[model samples]
Each structure stands twice: as C-alpha cells, then as structure tokens.
Target: MGVSGGSPTSRFECTRRLSAADSQCIWNAIAEIGARVGDRFTSNVPLFNCFGDHKMAVRGLVSARPWVADDGQEGGGGDGGIMMVAGYPSLREAVIAVAKKELREDRVSREQALQLMKEWLQKSQDIKNGRLDDAFILRFLRVKKFSVPLAQQTILKYLHFRNIYSHYCRQLDYLEPPVYELLKSGYLFALPQRDKLGRRVIFANAGKLDPYKYHNTDMAKAHLVTYETLLEDEDNQVLGFNHVTDLKGVCAAQMTLWSPSELGAIIKLGEQAVPMRHKEIHFLNVPPAFRMVYDFCKTLFSEKMRNRFYLHSSLEELHQSVDPKILPKEYGGTIPMSEMIDMWMKEVSRKRDALLSLDRMESQKVMHSYKPRTTTPKASNGITSLPGSFRRLEVD
Candidate 1:
C-alpha cells in the first residue's frame, strides 16, 4: 500500500465519496508505474495496497510522470493529454498536488514548509548547501511525506555527512588525477535520458575497474561523487532513481582492496545520508564462480535495499526486471556504456572548477559528537554543544 494522505474533511451538509471511475483510474496509474519501473515498483508496494489516502498520495506520485500514447499519438483516459499516476495532466501539476496532499497530512502548509527550510539552512553550521531552494527542500519534504521538521532533520544530517567527507564532497576536481582515474575507469555512470517512468538510471560497472591501480576506496568515493553531482537535477530528486551494477569481473581478490570500513561508509551513504529515492537495483552479468563474492557482499546491504536487489544471470534474464530498451548495448540494449561514460565525464569536466572550490569552501559548523544537557540520570546536568570543536582534537 502506498503512504496514506492526511485526514480528509467533510463539506457542509455533504461528504464526497469515491466513484467507481476514480478507483479504476488509480488502478490504471499503478499499473502504468509498475510497468515503467519494470515491476519493481509493484513488487515493493506496501502490503495493504488498498484504496485510501495513501493510494491518493501514490496516485499523485505516479501522475508526476510524463504520459504517452499507445501508438505515440495520444493514450487512453488522459483525454489526449499526459496523465500522471494521480491523474494529473502534467508532472508539475502532480508534484503540486502531492506537495499539497503531503503537507496537509503532516499538518504543515506550503508556506510553513518553505519557512522551515529557510530556518534550517540558516541554522546550518556545516558547509552551506548552495541548493536550498524550495524545489530542493521539496525533494526532502516529498521523501519525508512533507513533514517540515523531518525534512529539516534530513537536510541537517546530509550536511553533516558532507562536512566529514569534504575532500571528496567539496574538494573533488573531476579533472584531477584521482578523480580522472575514476572517470577513465568507467566504474560508474548515469544515462542521458530517464526511463519510461522518469527515473534516473545510474550504473556501476563493477568489473570495469583494474583493482591493482587504484584502491577500492577511490572507487567508492568516485561513485559517491557521481551520484551527489547528479542530485542537482530536480527531476532526479523528485522522480527518484534506479541503480544497476555489472558483477562480471568482481572477485574475492578485488574485494580485498577495500576495507570493511570503506564499504560500510558506502552503504551508509546509500541507505541514510543520501536524500534521493531508490526505487530499484539490478546486479547484472553475475559470474557463476562469484559465490564467495556474493555471500560476503550481500549481507552488507540493508534489508530494504536487499529486497530491491535482483541478481540476473544473463541479459535476457535481466530483461524480466528492467526494460532492455533503456539499457546499454553491452547488455543487449540501446546506449553504449562507453558513450554514456564519456558524456558523463564531460559533465564532470564542466563542473571541475566548482567541484575544486567546494573543498576550499567553509562548511557549516557540524557537531561531530553530542553530550546531552542531562546525563540520563548518570550524565552531566549541563552539556556543551560542540560543532567543529572536535576538529582540533583530530591527530593526523
């Protein structure tokens, strides 16, 4: 079941009831989203999956996608126009609708949400985000179901993660040797176009790397760099993203290059700090002899992420989960991984100066550790809040 919306109200002397047509519309929208995401969308749906406020919210999310015609002209029920999952005529309308519905449920208004974001940004002690606009904040709000406070909390946590990883976060210059090695390695990439559902697709070529040249930490950091940069796109923030990794060359030996701590950080970034929706994940071309690799690697993912992971033995097998049309030619699809990587690298090059300047940019004051004002019956009654105060204590 999708997320339930806020409480509904009764009009004076009357109450509105859902019509049969409305129910059917929701069903259609769900089916379409399910199709666009290659069934993962439906598979991951909440168990209840019944018609209710959550369905309405889900509908709004669905309708946020661009529509199409069966024959490429015009489609059904859309009245010759695009229909979102929520039955809106356009993505903008659907985002607005979802925003309104979510805020209403959270007991917050649009103005309040906007104000809360402003206040959160103002209080940020770490590196200030250059992207604190309504649209950016709205992405967090959407993920948190428009709960202004929760969204604010998420933003703060993300900033803290950036502060700690400032070298990669602010100082990374894509053209620099460290970063360039990553781009040339073709270890990670994003497609130029969205899938049928308007979600961005990011690929991690697990086998593409030469493990001996660069440490696995470099691979992990580069992957984070690519994803973080892509976060600037509004559509990716809203519609969300899909991930695929080629496991063709990954082996136990390659695993030895990265320490457990580095791997944990990557997982944390994916499951916690990142503010984007992860709709699905695919592991393609998994080699049969990679059992040791699978056993060791699988447990590292969170249950929710693990549930989304699909191991496909072959390209044809993967087509069952992802549309082959959207994949690269190496996997029997349209685009070439080489081309995608090249284009993405060029994008990184274009942002080179900005990325380098980030390292030099002052981060907002972020608390490295917390001492509560109360000692929980055994702690200090008065605690000191230290933001960046601990930085001086770090040795080497």
Candidate 2:
C-alpha cells in the first residue's frame, strides 16, 4: 500500500499510514492500473481497511468508471472506483529544466515571467475550469516567448477551441475503448526515436483508419491523447515535433469520410489551439486523389504553416528532410512499425493517470457560455473559412 497523493475533496483516508509492502502481488496490482512510482497505490491487500463507499477487494484496483463526466462525477459502478493519483518527482525535474531553458533562451526567468502572467490570468475570465499550474503556464510562456499578452490570448484561443468543439474534445480518455483501440491499432503514434533535429516524430497511416469502426470524434480523441502525451516531454516542448502521415492505399471512402467542417477542425487544432512548435507536416506516399483534400485544407493553414507543409512521393524524398534512422522499417528504418507502436502504448500506460485527469479540463460552464462565429466567409477559391478567431486574427 505505497499510496500518497489524492484530490482535496476525496473523502477516503486511512486512520494509520500504511507502510510499503515488499510483496510481488502489491506491485503487480499497482501496475495493472498503470500506476507510476509515486502514484498513490491503494488496493485490497487484506491489511488496509476500506472506507468512503469503497469495499475491499482481494485482487487489485479496478477502473469501474472509465469516463469522468463534465461535472466531475465518475460514471458507472463498482466499489466507487479506484482513484489513480498523478505525480512523479522526475516530471517535476523536467518542468524545472524547461523553465531554465526558457530563461536561457529568452533571458527572462520563469519566476518573473509567471508572476506577471499570474496577475493578468487571475483577472482574465478565460480558462475558468483549468489549472494554471507552473508547468502548464510555462508551456504557453515558452511558446509565446514570454510575451504575457500573447500567451494569455493563446490560452484563450485554446479554451475557445475546446468550447466550440466540445463534442469532439470532451472527455478525451486514453483508456476509453474506442480511443484505446485506435492507439493499439497504430493509426497514429509518436516514433520511439526523435528526428535528427531532436524533434519528436508523429507517424500516422491513413490506410489503417477504419471509418466504419470508429467515428470522427473517436479519431479526434485519439489524436488528442497521443499529441498531449508527446508534449509532456520537455524536449518535445522545446524542439517541437514533425508529423508524417502515409497516404498510401487510402481510398475515396476514407478521404471523403472527413467533412469540410471536420477538416477545418483538424486544421484549427494544429494551427491555433495547441501550444506546440509544429516544425513540419510531411505527407508520404500521397496518392493523386488526396491532392484535392490537400489543396482544400491548405486554405486553412497560416502562411508560416503553409511553408512548413510538405508532400513526399517516396521514402527517399521524405528522408531528405527527416532522418531515416527515426522512421519504422516499413519506411526504411531499423525498427518495425509494431515495435514503435508498442513503445508509444507503454508510454501512454505510464502516463495513464495524468491523461485521465484531463477529464477535469472539460468545462461544461465554458462550453455553454461559448458563442461561435456565425459568419464563416468562403475564399474566392470556394473554400469555406473556419469560424472564430485563430493566430491569423488581425489584432489591433
């Protein structure tokens, strides 16, 4: 029973502190719930008494409720659910390292920068339900180059994106059945190795997408889980990442599956919402048919992003920009695609609690109060521009 942290509101507590048990069963039970070294380990080990609607079990902690609702209520039943607390000392070290890096690059210490940001953010009506933790605020500060006003606006845009697209963005649980299936299916994942520039490589196979089996919302949630997990690494935050999607064998059915608005949503998320440095997006083995969709989507990209966008006819061409050593064997690298996917899955499992805790960010109050832009003007090329403000907004 090597358990420690919990939510302030959680009523469960032991009258006496439980010592770490030197039992293999205890370790195995903890691992089943994807617990990290510092995560609170609570299980039915026959030694600790169960309290607060949770009955003691013989085997291990179970996830009775997979989804945490908008109002912070756990859905489903069984023993009131085993709560997985999220924290690790190494993660704190990583955050410190990132803050130092920002200081080195921008000559502004994180302490000074965040102090200024905190004053403004405290008064700002944006991010009503989100945590403004040091690490979280540092993410925006680093990306915006310590410009408090810019960082604040970016945070607002991110929240607005989530509110406007709550249907797709809400309750993005990695362990959720559909998202988990997509994660294990290798539809999208971060490569085990980084590119030559030290950027993370996000690989996707369009051929693997089963439109009939999974909805657009499921795909959105899966992508969110994968990207959010990748961004947790401080190195990824600084160096950013490359996106490579293999369009080989993609049929008309799969291409047509994403409606124009859905396509706009994807573009908006990558370009405006996420506070990540997206270095490049390479479309490998792209067929002639995809050109139509590509051209249409290009309308949504900012000029800077349009410059970062690339199209590759073969692995040879892709290798010119990205290192071959970072790619999977199918793309002429040493490791197999399955192995890369397995590595990503293990990383996801390790961060399971943190990923699940993202449920708290889904604020119904924000969504209900959000007002979408009614006028979405179309370009002369006949492409309907995405609604609402983005990075390209004309700021006074």
Candidate 3:
C-alpha cells in the first residue's frame, strides 16, 4: 500500500487502499518525474542512491519468515509471532526516529540532510567492500536514532535537487539550437566507433546505385553544406570565416568570435558531424572565399575525425598548400582510391590468413594433446625422468 509520510494524518495516504493498478499508476507518476532529472546527480555521482531504506525494506520483505513452532505448541503457539515481529521497530524505523528528532531540533538544513544521505550511500558502498559492517537493519536503526531530522532533510533535499536539476537540464536542452536542428533534420543516429583509439569511424552501407554512394564525392558535398548551415545559424563570424579559409594562419591560428548559441552550435555540430556516413569529403571543394569557413568546420572534429577526413586529397591539398607534410605519401603521397582500396583488401586478407593458420594450429594442438585412458604411461616410475607430469604418469 502507498503511504504518504510528508503529510500529516492517514487521509493523505492515497495508496493505502489502492488496488494494484492504482498503485502502479501512482508509482509511474513518481518514476516519470525521476527519469528526467535523475541523470544530473546520478550521471557523475557514484554513490548517490546506494544506502536507502528502500533496499532494506526489499531485503526484509523478500526473506521474512513466520516464527517457528514451539516444542509443544498448537498452531505454532497461536499467531506465529508475525504481528509482534512486524510491529517491532526495524533499522528503517530507528533511522526515521532519529531523523524526526533532528528535524524537531533544527540541527541541520535540508541540504545538509541530503549531503548526509549521499554520505550514507558511500557508506553502503564501503560495506560492500568489507570496510564497514554489513548489518543493514542495524545500520538503518542507528542512522534513524542519531539523525531523524537530518534524514528528513535529506529526503526533502533530494527531492528538491531532483526537481531543480531536471528543470535546468531541460532548459539547457531547449536553448541548444543544434539539438533543434538535429530533431528537425531527423539525422540523429548512433555515433560511430572510435578509430586508432582516438579517431571516430562511421559505417554506412553505400552499395552501387545510391546517389550518395561515392564516399569522396557525394557524401563530402552533403557534409560541406551541413557544416556551412550549422555555422551560419550560430552567427559565428570567426568560425564562419574559417570555414572558407585554406591557410592554417587564417583557419587554425585566428580565433573565431562566436556567441554562446554559436559555440553550442559548433560543439553540437562537431559531435553530430563525426558520425556521418562519409569521410573523404574535403573543404577545399568549396570556393577559396569559403575555405576558412570549411576549415573551421573541419577543426570541430575530434582527433579521429581529423585523421580520417585529413586522408582526403582535397583536404590534403589545402593542408599541403599550408604545409607539405600534411598529406601522407600514400595518395600520390596521397593514395589513389583504387590503391587505397587494394591496400585495405590486402591487409584484410593477410589478417584473415593469419587467423586461419592460427586456428588450424590450435586445432592440431588440441588433437595432439588428446589421450585415451587405455594408452600406456609416457613416463617411467619415480626413478625415471619425463618431459611432463602426464608423460611421467603414462610411463609409470
């Protein structure tokens, strides 16, 4: 049954008489609120919800038993002691008592109480590590006895923080323009796997007939447009200018001034653009006037993206114009598409052959190691030497 602790009197306990369905509805309402704001504290805080009374209640409820029968009693000595034991104070009860006392005394603020709860959660974790006593009921009782007001404050503080944090996060999401753009474009998808431990890798199925199939051509065009639009919306003139620049001094060294919306847009766009299906697109394809803007867009990528996208010749050419070493020797010192593909295929085949050989060797080893119980011992008795214990046993 649902119980309301905050309000005085039994009349406020709506769940007390609720049916299963009604109880579920009430719980769902609470959970819905929790889902939105729960991440703020929980995402970074490790021990946020560990030492709660809910856990103790769950443990007690799951393992409770009726009193055992006396040596010569009828019907297990009248009501099985269930009512008495159930009525008796538990750890949770003691904690509640202490929390109440503190509340009456005004010994702690609601925020302090919440901090205590967080501390208690850490204590619970310590218990798991054998650093503290694991007596759940006893611990609860002790906490209740010593800090009733604090406990109450903690509960209130938690609820307060949850509500506040949730609202704030929602507001942040609302203010983020890129998020709106993403939602509008319906381009949201799972981010790609990271490459070379630092670079991001996006996977796409671009078989022959698709209009955007060429990784270097069509996909690049789409990314260029997307990057430009994202930059324009931010009103970030520096980044905007960089998006079109080719020179490192113009694109990388010069700082672009952008508003908060522009900065947020840049961050979000960088994160979002990393997972797009193509990597070979180049910013140089855009006119020289827009090269700074394109470079600014390129700069937003993580190291992985830089590595992958830098592989494109248009990108390399732009880089080489600024610095010759920027493009690797593979693709005319920049690898051709056919040569790159061939190199990738050879690497794949080499690895595949190695794996097959390793597997075959492992299989042969397993077969060789197999022995029948009927076979003679390979080793002589204690007086003789053998290569292994099994060989010695076999010889004997």
Candidate 4:
C-alpha cells in the first residue's frame, strides 16, 4: 500500500493482504457503520470510508501487490505496504482546538478562570451544594467566553431558575415512567448527523405527543435530560446547536399546553441557563394560527437569540438555513427518521448511568434566596493576653 494526501486529511494505500479473519472483522465493522464496499473479500477493494464526530473520516485501503517506497525501497521487503489507520483528531482534541481559537481558552486561561470560579463559589450565597468540578465550571466559562464574573452570574441564574421551577428540574430520571414514555414517543430528539457547521440539531415535533397523556413537566424533564446527554459530547458544546421544530400537526389545543409564564421560563432557560449556544432555531411547516404562539415565544427570546430565530413555510426554506444532506428523509434528507431517532435513543441508553445521576444533583431549593452580607463582621482586637501571663486579662 502507498500513502498519499487526499482532500479529507491524509489518505493511506494498503498493498498488503490480510488474513480471512481480519478481513471479516473489517467487513463487519464497515457494515455496522453503514458504508458500502463492493465485496467483503480483501482483493484490493476499497474497504470503507465514513466521517464521524465532526469531519473525522475513517477510511480503509487494501492492495494485493507490494508497495514500493519513494526511495526505491519496498515496504516490508516488497511483500506489502504497511496497513495504516488514521483519524484527524478525537472530539476532545477538536474541542481543545476550538476552545483555543474561538473561546480564548488555553492552559493558563483555563486555570485562571477555574480559580476565579472557585473563589466565587466560596462567597456565593445563591448556589448551595453546587457542582465545583472543572468540567462543570468550564461549561459556564466557555459559554461566557471565559469571563469568570459572567460565568459566575450565569451559574447563579441557572441554579435560581431550577430553584423556582423545581417541578420541572428536580428528579429528572430518564428511566422514570413519564420521562421514558415521553422520550420513546419521538417528540423530541437530536439528529444523528450534525449540521454543516458541526452544530447539533435537536428536532421537536410539537404534535407528536398526546396533550392529555404527557404534561409540560414530563416534556421538560425529557428534553432537559436529553440536552444533558448531548452536551456530554464536546463537539456539541463548542459548536453549539440548531433547534428545528416541526409544527406540522400542532393543534390549537397543543398551543395551550404551556401557560404564558411557563413558556417564557423555558425560553429564558435556553438563553440564560443553558451553557450551549443557540446558533439558530428553524421552525418548519408552521401553520398560520401558530404564528400567534410563535410571536409570544419570540417576545421571550433575548435580542441575540431573536436574530437567530427563523420560520420556514416549507422544507425547502428550511434547507436554505440547515443543510438538507444531514436531515432525515421526511424533512428532505437521505437518512430515515426512524434511524435518527434510534441513534438518539441509543445515546440516551449509552449515557444511562450519567443521566440517572442527575437525580442526585442539587435539585432541592437552591440557595438563591440567601443574600451575602456586604459588610464583614469585625474581629475583636481590643483585648489581648500578655505573653507568659496565664490569667485572662480584661481590656476596654
């Protein structure tokens, strides 16, 4: 096999023959990834190539003949070329790169930011028993562009929101009957494929759920836990998200699902509490009547988010905003909706333990009600005991 450069990172050529068992293993893995390679046999056929996790392409190359080096030396004594498997970078590495370039994050800044957060947490009376790990702190820091004060404020606000909406935020166990049923209902899910800009797309079908069966609290828990699962992937954090809501079958009754205040709270949560960026929100197949509800929601969005909000009358218009290539077939894409929803369910299952542990989070009344005393209590310095004097001395 020979190694060469190609459009996607680097390309490798394989001029070596593999054992039947090895070939079968490769075939199985390739098939699992849903890529097509003509024959299963390793007869100089290109095995498979597919991109995963933000443009990291995995390709297989096989050649029957021995490969010669550029310097006239044969690879492995002219028997065959070395089989090479290469990937661009892991999601963590890619996130690091993105953080450096976009979030102004590096070792020095990260340490400094985390230290500042540590100090803030100590003095904070708003958040009690809050998460103090680097991952939790860095989430806010990154969203605030590493401004420690801003991140601190956001954390406090987030905890405060949860405090006020304990019904929605507390005990968010995905395995719970209500949450599990809502998740299985296919009402809301993250698309298997990311958008063109590598941002995760969360699809919500407003009409998919039965209003009588699933309440707003159930919907809230399901969506919140799902977002938590998606955010575990660093790619989603840095690149942010694109929310696509299909209002095809949304009825007037469904519009009344949430009270005005409740609806506002959800919108505010996305803007102020959540650490992920709202790159764009595409509302597709909107009925004329839904415009009133959409307008109400729009009023709740921040000015920055308001700019990213878009309404699409058709899938064609949606494709203009979001790439159709990554969308499911029903939405004018190649992939099937069932497959994408299954992918989301699998992700939820894979992160089952972590998601369930959310129940252990500080869901009880967050200490937002407490206010820090601005004036420090003065220590008594008026009295002192003389050295070598074993008796108490009185002083004015």
- Identify the leading candidate in terms of lDDT: 4
Cα-based lDDT for every prediction: 0.56, 0.59, 0.28, 0.61
Candidate 4 Cα errors over 4 Å, as ranges = 1-11, 14-97, 118-128, 363-396
Best by TM-score: 4
Q: Ranking by lDDT, best first? A: 4, 2, 1, 3
lDDT of 1 by residue, 1-396 (tens): 122233222211111244557645764666665445422232236632664554544444334333332322212111212323335434444434544553352334656777877776776665454465565566677677667778867766666666665534555556557667777777787764555555667878877666556654466568766766666544456666788888776644455454455556656755666777787888887665665456556788778777887788787887787767667787777767686666667555544654455444344566673221121111122222222321122211
lDDT of 4: 0.61
Residue 233's lDDT in candidate 3: 15
Candidate 1's TM-score reads 0.63
* Residue-wise C-alpha lDDT for candidate 2, range 87-206, written one tens digit per residue: 321222333444456434343566787888777666655444465666577677778867778887777777667777765666767788988888888899887665554456789987
* Backbone clash numbers for all candidates listed: 21, 1, 39, 3
Give candidate 2's total backbone clashes: 1
Instruction: Name the lDDT value of residue 47 in candidate 4.
Output: 36
TM-score of 3: 0.18
Better of 1 and 4 by TM-score: 4
Q: lDDT score of model 3? A: 0.28
